[model samples]
Target: MIIPDWLSDLHFAFSHRGDGQMSFKHADKDVVLESRNRFFHDKGLNLDSVVTGELAHGAEVALVTEADAGRGARDRNWIEGIDGLVTDKPGILLMTTHADCAPLVIYDKAHKILGQAHAGWRGLASGLIESLVGRLKSLNGTGPSELHAWIGPTIRACCYEVDRDVADRFPDHCRFLAGESIRLDLTMFVHRELWRLGLNPDYVTDSNVCTSCNPEFSSYRRDGLNTQAMACITGIPE
Candidate 1:
């Protein structure tokens, strides 16, 4: 588990190797998840408390509750078409799957509200960050200043070559010409969005790990169909 240092108030982790394939969607056929079960069991986190969505790669942010816990644990209890989740429930672990896509970990310590989002280029274009912020705002009015977002490791512009069609969706500043090919800086783009929405620029941290270049992390764009996903999760209680 790769833990971010700044998020001191919450129990959060962006899992890499040794954590296993968290999702059954891309689990290995021959390999069982008993070790994976033991992993969470050691942390005293019930897999049943983990909440996930169907993940449509869009901007649908869902409000999770204590009742919504375990919806997507070991079964197909995910909310449909949602790419973001915000919860005020303490024990409920909010999670999102990623393989080169940005795994956004959000926490408003003052209000004790936590959120997780899966933002790829499509999700960014659809304004998933803004939607997540908006949802948290409505959740007892926790504003941007109180929220601290950590943009977890993913493919960066150095290896994320894109075409014009994909590049056009982003701001001109977020795109750069790379010898006839365009590269999109997702971390920069995400920072711009969060800052634009009034989040303190200092609080928005990005882990500049490029999944495409780094062998330690998984990248679907680089590893193709056989790749596994990384899970980023955060909760209020210990």
Candidate 2:
């Protein structure tokens, strides 16, 4: 698995090799599909299970249990409207897709509970991060201090401009770019949310890669409607 330089020592894993590449694996496939196939083909995963949602930018979190195993690379009968997924089952990869939205991954090492959340501005404002953490705690008795978090690549403050209406939705503590056009720092907002949830700042790692600034990444802000998203996935090795 390719680990980006900004997220060193987090122990949580994700792929970064597709950077600057325009192959079918990165361009055409959803992040979950690409990650599942890579893990399977590389002989790193024993279970082929993957779960995601319709991602309506809400705070809903779906639980992936043993019954949901081996569902990866298969079409579902109905899409669940959720922004986060959590599981303790080994080989059951929990994934969330993002183009410019920050992909948040959390792992509770003691309990082996892993979680992935999609945090766009709307999701962030809706308290998705807190919802995921609360669910993890309830399901696995995992506390904020015991969990490790990784914030993935997304639209950075340099390119994520927001109007007053959107900016007002966030807490006053969030950082913002100055000027007539107000750009917000989403990664910082996520970091603040982590802190608010009682997770130590030291336990959180930020990718710091701006999708809008880097041509290697897919960016809705840059490509408009044509942006292809990347996936951030996590699970216990079976």
Off by over 4 Å in 1: 1-6, 28-35
- Pairs with backbone N, CA or C atoms under 3 Å apart (clashes), candidate 1: none
Model 2 scores worst on lDDT over the 10 consecutive residues at 17-26
Tens digits of per-residue lDDT for model 2 on 7-120?
342223444425321122234345444544665455344424656666778899888886766443444421367888888777676655667888888878778787888889
So what's the TM-score on candidate 2? Answer: 0.82
Candidate 2 error regions (>4 Å): 1-47, 70-72, 76-79, 175-177
lDDT of 1 by residue, 89-185 (tens): 8889887777899988878878788888999999999999999999988885656887888888889999999988999888889999888888999
In model 1, what is the error at residue 78, expressed in angstroms?
A: 0.8
Clashing pairs in 2: none
Cα TM-score of candidate 1: 0.92
lDDT of each: 0.81, 0.70
State the weakest 10-residue window (summed lDDT) of model 1: 28-37
Cα-lDDT of candidate 1 = 0.81
